[model samples]
Target chain A: MNTEKILLDHGSGGKISHALFADLILPLFDNPELSCQDDGAILDFEPGRLAFSTDSYVVDPIFFPGGNIGDLAVNGTINDIAMCGAVPKVISAGLILEEGFLLKDLKIILESMASGAKKAGVKIVTGDTKVVPKGKADKIFINTSGIGILPSGIHVSGNNAKPGDQIILSGTLADHGIAVLTAREGLSFESDIQTDSAALNTMTRQIIESGCDVHVFRDPTRGGLGTTLNEIAVQSKVGIKIYEPSLPIKGSVQGVCELLGFDPLYIANEGKLICFTSKQDAQKTLEIIQKNEFGKDAAIIGEVTHTDPGVVLLQTAIGGVRLVDMLTGEQLPRIC
Target chain B: MSLKYVEEFRDGALAKQIIKKILAVSKKPLRLMEVCGTHTTSIFRHGIRSVLPKNITLLSGPGCPVCVTAQKDIDTFIHLCKQDDVIITTFGDLIRVPGSGSTLGKEKAEGADVRVVYSVFDAVHIARENKDKQVIFCAVGFETTTPTIAAGILTAAAEHIRNFCIHPANKLTPPALAALMETDGIHIDGFILPGHVSVITGTHAYKDTFEKYQIPSVIAGFEPVDILNAILMLIEQNEHNTPGLQNAYPRAVSDLGNIKAQKITSQVFEPCDAVWRGIGSIPSSGMALKKEFHPFNATKKFNIQAIDTPEPAGCACGKILMGLKNPTQCALYKKKCTPMTPVGPCMVSSEGACAAFYRYN
Candidate 1:
């Protein structure tokens, strides 16, 4: 119990493995399904469509401002399910730990994961752990798979975006990306910016159940708003037009991005979503989203157009129009 | 947390007024070239091209260090990456730039030790930490980045870090401008000078080129308002037939520029004939490490040889850099070359004209 670092025996499936489960994971997760200590978790579900999602977290620096990989992994899968207009029910975690990783760090990560699941009202039903050599892996890597139930009356898809649909963005952009980049070694900067890695299931639920003509619910995660919009545009065979002045972004995040010669549109966002709804229902959906704590800065950013199908356009702040192409390759930091 | 300068320059109302002025004054078919890659990116990012009159065309010049880097130098970099016990540190902009055979990105994927550093000092730190490994910093930039590389060399020497070195691919901005003016069949009405480079070299650095050519020029910042204002000044100069150089970005650029930075740069590097990627060789356009700093020169210390690499077939990056051709004019532009599968440095470098045009237009 007082082991200072993880060891090979931690994954041996013997006494040490059992102790690690009981002493660390069990008390933290503290759920009946996981307490069974069996090969798999058993659960009951109503007859409905099930939305399942899986994601892996290998973000460098493992820890960053505002959140760490633990909560990021948890919330990532939850948001994926929620984006399908489903209520996240349960999640399974798989951990890959390095042998020399600090036990204290592991406990902190587990604590965050447990608390993140509790906040999202989802249970950590089952998980597996494996220990690798010290140099074989980073400190820790977590993979989470989640399942959610979709109600019968609610249906949403990226292909459902119509010509007269309006696009709504939840909160600000580029907070999570800038936060992680600054926290990285050899690139540290003095700033109070933090990752916006919060569970968006609550906000998604509010908009989904609001009786609006919702078309698409997407989280702009890795490629930011620009890539997500392109995906939706191509899927729906429509064109998108966004207003530059209407896009919400934190001042600190914007400053960092500008300094680094990065486009905020292509930067990553974690706790933000873009919704497509009929023009008449767009205002109602915006108000419903604004009622959530995570959607305070939400706004009607753009609209779907019938012309120029599969292209995304931006109405620049200076009243100019330009194409918004999907992000190509990785967004590298500029030289000057 | 308050980005005061950033907010002030990006004022939509100010940009609108300047744009309106530019629209009103622009009558003739004038082709203005922006000499800096950052300027090109700013113009595109703010949709400056869309706002301008159709008769007024903005041509991208050879200001991007990566886009202008010669094929031989890129080949030399890739060759150095293949050396044993060597760690190549470079700016992120140069990672995907293709040499004749391969790129630094491809070499890294093949298990080469290539690391991206934001500043030259980070490479020096890497060399200090890994004493057993020879860390070569790929120094590719203009006046805006050369002084920092000079400072990094100084830091390495003071600490006696012998393993740290840099491959000097630094270029001078003024010489390239003069070469552009001297080129035959090139018709440009005015020039929007680079703001960041001018911050170091000053408005005085371009005095010789301006006096000789009598071309209207304006140094501009990388903001919508700044670009629009610069465009308006160029239009006025052309219309009035009074060719002169103006400093539109006086907040960062002065007549004399940063004296200490210039001095430090001269202390470590000397002007040499450098071959530009799309353009041919130009005299005194490149900065080579001084004789005293030979030990810090990766090319000499590692005995690297430059290879003869030809430019891509049907690629107009060189013509594009000289403002003779646009990206769409190239046969390999969007069809065979893209940001994901770039056939030229103009498509690889984030600030390259092709990249800015591809992403924004």
Candidate 2:
């Protein structure tokens, strides 16, 4: 129990493996299905339509300010399924550890995953672990697969967007990308920013249950809001226009982006979501989202237009219009 | 936390007021060129072109250091990566720039020890940490970045970091402007000088060029209102037939500039004739390490000979940099060249006019 670090033997399926599951993993994610310690967990469910998703996390510097790769993996997969208008039920995790990774850090990560699953009202039913030699991988990586049940008479898709649909962003942008970049060694900066990684299933589920004409529910992750909106606009064959003044951005995030000469719209956001709905329900949905803990800064930022199909335009604060194109490649810090 | 400077300049009302004044004073068609990559990016990001009067045409100039980097210098960096126990360090902007046959990025992917660093000091640190390997920093930039590199070399010398060296491809702004004016068939009515460079060399740096060329020039900050205000100043100067060097960004720049930093740059480097990518050679426009500090010169230490590398055929980057042609006028823009398979440095560098045009237009 006092082992300071993981070794190759941790994945040998011997006493070390069992202790890793018992002393660290089991105490945090205490559940009967995981307690069985079998190859798979037996599940019972009623016959209904189901949704499934799987994703892997190999984030550098596995630990960040607000959260780490563990909870990010869980919340990412859960939100993926929830954005489909389904209630995420069960999840599985797979861990790949480097030989020299600290077991104490592993415990912290597992506890984070547990808390995230607990808040989302889901269970981590089963998982597998494997350890690689030093230099074979980064410190740690996680993969999560999730399943959710779709309720009757509920459907949401990117293609469901229509002209006159309003776009509602969940909250402030660019916190997670800036946090991760600044935390990296040799790039440290004095700032109070932190990663915004969290589960968005609760609010998304409420919106679906509110009987609103919700067209699309998307979490803008890697490419941020600009690329996400472009995807929806293309899929729906409609034009989109965003008001630059209405974008919910924290002053600190804006300052960092400006200093780095980066566009806040193209930066990543871990916890923010973009909801596309009819104009009539945009205010109601915005008010509903503001009620959730993660959606306090939500606002209706843009709307779908009929002209210039598949193009996203931005109306600048000074009354100029330009195309908000999809992000072509990775955004990097400028030398200036 | 207040970001007072950013908020004040980004004011929508102030931006509108500047545009209104510009619209009122602008009578004749004017050809204005923004002479900084950061300005190019800011203009596009703010949608400045969309709101400008049709009579005023904004053209991107040779302000991007990456775009102006000599083709031969890039090829030399790629060749140095092939040397034994040599690790090439560079800024992110120079990584993907294509030379004659390869880039540092391709060399790294092929197992060369090429590392990206935010500053020259990081390369010095890497050399200090790894005594067995020689760390060569690719020093590519304009006046705004030269002083810091010079300071890093001084730090390396004081600490006796013998394993660190620099491949200097540094350029000057005023000489390039003078070169552009001397070029035949290049017509630029006014120039929006670079703000960051002006902050270092000060407003007096452009006095000689301004007096000789009699060109209307304004050094403005990199904000929406700042740029619009500069445009209005240029229009008024042109309308009244009065040409002068005006510092629209007076908050940071002064007549003398930061004297201590200027002295630091002079102590480590000397002016040399440097070759620009499409513009050929501009005399006394580039900086090289002083003879006393020749040990810090990667080219001298590695015994690498400078070989001229030819630019891509039919590439209009040269004409674009001089504002003689637009990026759309290029035969290969968006056809054979793009941000993804870029054949020219203009297409690759983030602040390149071709890139801004492709992304914004």
Candidate 3:
């Protein structure tokens, strides 16, 4: 098989998928935990609460501004586990490769995945692979399931959000979406804009270690912070009120969104997350998050509310309230 | 904390006052045409249409470059994609724009050598690296994007990059608008001229259209207040029976426009007859690479044939773009031609009328 040319057999479940994984994937991401082939790997550690989470990545232009499918796959899962107020320890990868995908590209992706795992202090413990016909799938789609161990007395969940709980965003909104859109649109500006795709587990770990009693945690990926908050509101049966003025937005991303007729709030993001906690602990959480490199622009943007259950409302910079709902469909650029 | 001139222009108080004046002056069921895609988006984003009186209907026009690109042009670019040693680069918005049956995104997924690029410069850079492949920039947009392509062409010429070429589908705004007025089925009371395009071509260019149609034209910025003020200006003019050109985006656009950008565009391109998606053929509405710059023109370099193809049956994007129908009027709009699975030009182009309605409304 030519490493540069992808074939239909690669996506076939029997021989092609296994050979592709063993030859191209395993060598790049060679870790002891992943070597043991089982239904699921068993970890031996001291008694503590375990955090398990799963995520799927299907971003277009598979490779984008700051990162590609490899790092994105690892970071997404790690972030999910971290959101549970735990330190991510292990991950399992499942790949859905399209037939006729270049093996060289897959190798590059594996190397990125390995590096991302190293950065987030996590190990690839187990994995599975499947390949489909060229037309049956995108070039490559990855799903990652992660497991983490939380420290004693640390608990976090979406339903834990309470009234007057301060809402904090790690950094800017819509960076990942704009970066993806810019790359996808084939529109360029004078400044080079890259995706803010990175593992937020480190930042989350520091905040949890600060003993600020984080009530809830969520990484706003698809549907951005607005949709994520709306989901939390619905799940927790509470209201979320956000101040538009406090939302951190990069000037370039804002300009592109304005020019392309996109709302920053509705756009997708990958690297940022939201934390909801008590007002008293909010200051300490903000300070701890600010100390980290990724959380430099961390801000307390809003608070959870008891009014208007299951709704997310935004107070505009001009002091007007508007309902921020989950984006109904894919946001296409509109000339009007 | 500093509110720039553009920021102040969107003030709600000013917008409310302008809306009041527009309501007071206009007759019942006044139809105003917004001729820029940016204006349409701003109108929807700011919910300007909701705040206005029910009788005052703001109609979307052929201001979107993506919606106006003819099917033949898209087919020609898709044909270029069939070549093994060819890399077809274009803006993200153009990827899903339907040609006849399939889109560029679909073609790319089906193993076509297509890549989305942010700028023409990126295409040039790709050409610089892949000397064996022909890098064709799927050059689409109005005057707002023309200058960048012109600059890229100049750079490619100076750099002597043999692999780079442009499939120039770049159209001028005023000529298409003029064609709409001359054609049947258009009964517009006034015009809301596009702000960004005017910043490039200048507001003076619309003087002829205003004089010819006896309609008031206001080059307005993409803001709530700017659009409202334009409507008020148009209503005021209609009431007084005085038709002329006005500037509501005075901070950015002047009567003359950006002289440097215009000079660059002129140096690289010449006015040519172009096929608009909805409004048939319009003379001098399209820009083509000059004879001296023919080597960099993708159409000439690849001998691309312009084939006549019809839009998908029952798709009202063409009519919608021409201000003859609304998006909800289209049978396929919500059912088949959505943002994810676009089946028409209006659904495909990000700046298209149908796309705007689907996204905002």
Candidate 4:
């Protein structure tokens, strides 16, 4: 507690390591399973299918407008499991810190992660920490792995999309990507853009419990909606047609994209999900999503098609149709 | 947080009305070429081609600075990066553009000091931070970008930043349009001129080409409504047999253009003969740093002469740029040539005709 910066001894698994965990980590992520101090946490679940997911957080700056890397890491794994129509139960955190990384920053990140788990009604059961030399790593990196239980007769996957299924986006696009890019070291732009990083497991639970016929649930993260939709089209052997006018994007985010010559469709999102539901239940499903705190801007953006299988088409605002191809390489800014 | 102009330009009802007007006016089997790469991208991005009449063909032209960058210039950029105590800073697209032997991205992976900077001023900042290293910015853009690069040079010169320099591969748009008109087998009825470049060059810049060739030309913005409005103007001109240069993007572009930016560009650089990637060299189409700014010229500072190299075999990027061929006409397209493994710069740059066609089509 007296240390101003983390050192190699803090991760040695000796006296210093235990003191660091008991004083700093344990107080924030307090729980019965984590307090036992065993090799791993033990848990029991009711009769159901198990959904396990893991993700690593290596975002630059490690902090942004709405959220930092800590909550992002926690919510990312929780959303992954939730996308499979499961209720996320417990998560494990793995931290990699630089020797000279500030202890204060670590405390803030840990506190956010703890709160993120509490809001999602999940437990931080077990965790591990390691420290490398000062120059060996960028400030800090986190890996979170979580498990969830799926209820009976719940089925959702990328390949489950069928003809006539309406596509519902949870919210606006490119908030997280633009927020992080603008906050980077040299590229400075004045805007109030914040990362839409939040736990979506609660929203997913409502949709699953409602018993509306659902086909697919995917969080458009790294590749955004464009790449994720292409993946679904290929996986389902169906075509998709999204209306340009129906896409919910913030005006400021669109402005940034125009200035940098980036397509919002290909930008990343952290707290959004794309759900595919039958036409009969699409309206009810949309209403359910709109009621959630993170789904105020949820909209039915597109629909699955029978023609042009394996291709995703966008019905442009100007009444023309074009292919929304999968992202080729990193979406680099145009020269002119 | 909302942009007023962007929304007004992208209004769905306004775009639909323009499309309807274009449909009614476009009667001839005309082939219109959008000279700017940004126009080509906007046309595809808004699915403008799908709404136009079947008789009208929108051809992509040699406006993309990165796609039209010569192999020799790309080689020079990679060569500069390989030098010790040197850092090659460039726009994002140029990193993946393949040269004769290797690309800047590949070279960077092999331990070369290469960085993708958002602006030329950022490269100047890099030079300031790394005092021992030489920062060479790979400058490839048209009139819309050249003024900014020139401004960066002025900043570096004023601050006495000795290690900062630029590889001036900048090009002028008006000359390229003239060259396209003279090319054999080229058949273009009208032109959807680049909005950004025209903003700097002004509506008067295309006067020579418009008068000499008697072709219909209209400056356009990148939004759907702006492009559709420009297309309608071009169709009306062609139908009435009145070939003239018009400016549809009057909000951003004017007859005189940005006079201050033009002055700054002339202060730092002069017109020079530059080679195009697929097409051969055109006279006075490229820009070179002025003699007074010789110390800020990367080509002279490094004493490196990049010999012109042959383009990749069986690539039809040149023909495509000239509006003589489409991407599918190329034997390598969608087969050996793709966005992931591009054989030509056209496939790598986001504003490239091939990349736009591949993505939207």
Which consecutive 10 residues in model 3 chain A have the weakest lDDT in total? Answer: A184-193
For model 4, residues A139-182, the per-residue Cα lDDT tens digits are: 99999999999988888999999999999999999999999999
- Candidate 3 local lDDT, B1-361, one digit each (tens): 2225645765666766776777677775678989887777667656677667787888999888788888888888888887778999887677777777677778899989897666788899999999999999988888988999999999999999999999988999888878888878688888898989999989888888777877778888876777788888888887788877899888899889999999999999989999988668999999999999999987778776667898778888778987889999989988987877777777766566787687655
Candidate 3: segments with Cα more than 4 A from true spot: A1-50, A55-75, A84-145, A149-170, A176-216, A226-246, A256-262, A266-271, A275-336, B1-28, B154-162, B239-241, B290-297
| lDDT tens digits by residue: candidate 1, B83-138 | 99999999998999988889999999999999999999999999999999999999
lDDT of each: 0.92, 0.90, 0.82, 0.92
**Using alpha carbons, what is the TM-score of model 4?**
0.98
Give the interface RMSD values of the models in order. Answer: 1.0, 1.4, 5.2, 1.1
CAPRI tier for the interface of model 2: medium
Give a tens-digit lDDT track for model 3, residues A198-310. 88988888887777879999999888887899889998999999986688988778777766567888887778889998999999999888888888898999999999998
Which 10-residue window of candidate 1 chain B scores lowest in summed lDDT? B1-10
Provide the fnat value for model 2, as a fraction from 0 to 1: 0.41
Alpha-carbon deviation at B102 in model 4, angstroms = 0.9
Clash count, one per candidate: 1, 0, 17, 0
Q: What is the C-alpha RMSD, rounded to one decimal, of candidate 1?
A: 1.2
User: After superposing candidate 4, which stretches have Cα over 4 Å from the reference?
Assistant: A1-3
**Candidate 4's residue-wise lDDT over B273-307, tens digit each?**
99998988999999999999999988899898766
Off by over 4 Å in 2: A1-3
In angstroms, the error of model 4 at A240 is: 1.3
